[model samples]
Target: MVLPSVLNADFGDLGGELQRLTDAGARALHLDVMDGHFVPNLTFGMPIVEGLRRHTDLPLDVHLMISDPLRYAGPMVDAGADMLTFHVEAVDDPAAAAQSIADLGVAVGVAINPDASMDQLEPCLDHVDMVLIMSVQAGFGGQAFNPIALERLRSLRNQYPDLLLEADGGIKASNIADVRAAGCDCFVVGSAILKSDDYGKAIDELNDQIASANPSGANISPGQEATR
Candidate 1:
């Protein structure tokens, strides 16, 4: 599913932006919450979340890139975040942290950086609802998608048939097919959708692109790792 990231959206006109996305066939919205320490950046807090809750009916797929995910999970969920994805690098016991957040009546997702190994992320797979493999470093948006992410996704998909895999960073109409082919069920799109001339049309094009990609396996053709 194409989950448009708020990080790249027009905050000045978020209401209209949300409406446009909903009309463009978006099933959910990806909200990136960054703390200055954990991600070297700062973004939406609970106040923003509370405000965002009233604007859309689409499920809020909140990604917490913070130093203290467990401490803030409840507040974010309480502010109407439907699903919370916390970075594994921030916590000591990822598995336990995942369950602790899950207990807040929301589906838990765990995110891993591009440099993280597959085995390091596997321990939390059984406990979380989804796994978000960051295609770029976790701090900011609009960075290039790392080719290593495809290998990580491929390895994870090959090993866990039931797990839901997601990919974020530098994904757009061009390389989306490759990412999908690499076994990402959820696509967290940012500027790819936001910066387009026609947001709805761009989203439609992306969805169509994803629909056309082979879903059976990571039949990655030689040198298919896209630069975009």
Candidate 2:
């Protein structure tokens, strides 16, 4: 599934931007909630996520790159986050955090940074619905894609075989196939889609590409190809 990260969307016209993406066939919305202390920047909070919830029917894939994620997990779920992800580096008890988020009836996810290993997520894989592998450092958009992460995704695929592996950071139409082949099923694209002059066209092209790559049309594999 292709989720367009709202971090790069135009805040001045959030509703319009969201609607455009939704209309363009985006299945999910990726919300990056950051705290300056955890990552070097700060982004949307619970209220904003709640507001976005009312604008679209698509599932909200919330990535919380903040400290004390356990403290904020409940509120984010209550505010309508369908799937919540917290950095593995941000919490001490990642399993507990995943459980807390799951308790709210929302899917749980764990994000591993560029420098973090897939081994760090091994203990908590069963508790999460997905594992987000960052292709670049957190807190910024439009950064270069780290090719090393591809190897990590391949490793995760070989190990888990059933976990949903998502890739975020520097994902665009041009490199979607490379990442897909490397074991990424869900893609979180930021500036690539939101910053484009032809947002709708770009999204269409991406979806078409994804479909072309996986003709079997099965749901996306945990780390391999996306099921059509």
Candidate 3:
């Protein structure tokens, strides 16, 4: 499904922005948590997630781009995160990390950068509920779309038919069709929805593309949402 990334949303008016996305048919929200050490950027922490949890019912898909995801996983989950994703590049034992996160009673997710491969995630595939495939370099927004992500998503789908695969970065209506056709179960969109003049219209247009792209006409029907 379409997961509107909060990284591009107005920090001054996030509640209203979230309400607008919900009304626009977005089923979930993607929160990018970056630590300077891991991604050369630092964003808000649990307080923001706590505040957002009080403001909306939409599931919070928290992506932790931190050096130590295991350190922050529990706190994020306690802050009302429904799905938690961490970079494989950050930890040595993916299975142990995934198990720990899964034990917290939320959907466990694993993410890989554009340069990373599906083989890197094989160790934690069965432990994770979803997988986030970064199309652009992590730590920034508004980068150009990368087609290599489509190939990766397709590769993941081939290996695990039912695994929930997500694609983040540089995604928009123009290329969403190809992304969906490549087997992305969730699309983490930033500026395309946040920068639009009309949130509802932009989301509707994306849904239309997702609908028409797949011959099976399946919705982004995953057990949870995903992130950057």
Candidate 4:
């Protein structure tokens, strides 16, 4: 699925970016909420998320890179987040945090930084609707993709065959195929699309590529080695 990362969007012209993504058939909007304490970079809060809620009808996939996700889960959900995803390393109780988000009647997701392992999220897998594998460090955007994170996503795809496997960070047309082959059904692309001169065209191209690779929209089975 196409999910445009809002972090790279033109904040000064937020509505324009949202409209561009929506017009280009983006399935969801990825909101990256970062707290300086957890990731060394501060980002938008509930007000922005709430304001964006009125801009588009696409599902708001909010990614929380903060210390205490539980504290903001309720407010985010109330502010119009359709799916809430938080870092596995941030929360004191990952499973509990996932449950709390799930209880808000929104889909719950758990994210793992490039250095985190699949085993770190094993206990909370069933409670989450999607598993986000960050292909770069959490704080900033436009960084190079970390190859190791691809393996982590491959592993999660093997263990939870039916769960949504999302990959974020350095996602562009160049690496979309490889990520898809690695079993990522959802993608959070930032600078790749937003920074392009033709934002709408970029999104259309990515969607076409994804569709061509998975015409049936079936999740490709992970490699045998990944299952272990």
lDDT of 3 by residue, 1-228 (tens): 888999999989987887788888888889999989899888889999999999888788899999999998889988999988999999999999999998888888899998876688989998888888999989999999888898888998998998888899999999999999999888999999999999889988888898889755445433332222
- Candidates, ranked, TM-score: 3, 2, 4, 1
lDDT of 2: 0.82
What are the TM-scores, per candidate, against the unseen true structure? 0.92, 0.92, 0.94, 0.92
With a 3 Å backbone cut-off (N, CA, C), the pairs that clash in candidate 3 are none
What CA root-mean-square deviation does each model show from the true structure? 6.3, 3.2, 2.5, 4.9
* Candidate 4 regions with alpha-carbon error over 4 angstroms: 217-228
Q: Which clashing pairs does model 2 show?
A: 217-227, 217-228, 218-227, 218-228, 219-227, 220-227
User: Which model is ahead, 1 or 3, in terms of lDDT?
Assistant: 3
Worst 10 residues of 2 by lDDT: 219-228
lDDT of 2 by residue, 1-228 (tens): 788899999999998998888777777889999999999998889998999988777788889999888889889977888888899998788887788777887777899898876667867887888889999999999899998778888988888787788899888878877777777779999888998888788887777676676654225422222221
Candidate 4 C-alpha RMSD relative to the actual structure: 4.9
lDDT at 53, model 2? 87
Give me the runs in candidate 2 sitting further than 4 Å from their true place.
217-228
Model 4 residue pairs with clashes: none
**Superposition TM-score, candidate 2 onto the true structure:** 0.92
| lDDT tens digits by residue: candidate 4, 55-171 | 777778899999989999999989998888899998768888888887888888899987776678988987888888999999999999888867876787787787888889988
What lDDT does the true structure give each of the candidates? 0.83, 0.82, 0.87, 0.83
Provide the global lDDT of candidate 4 against the true structure. 0.83
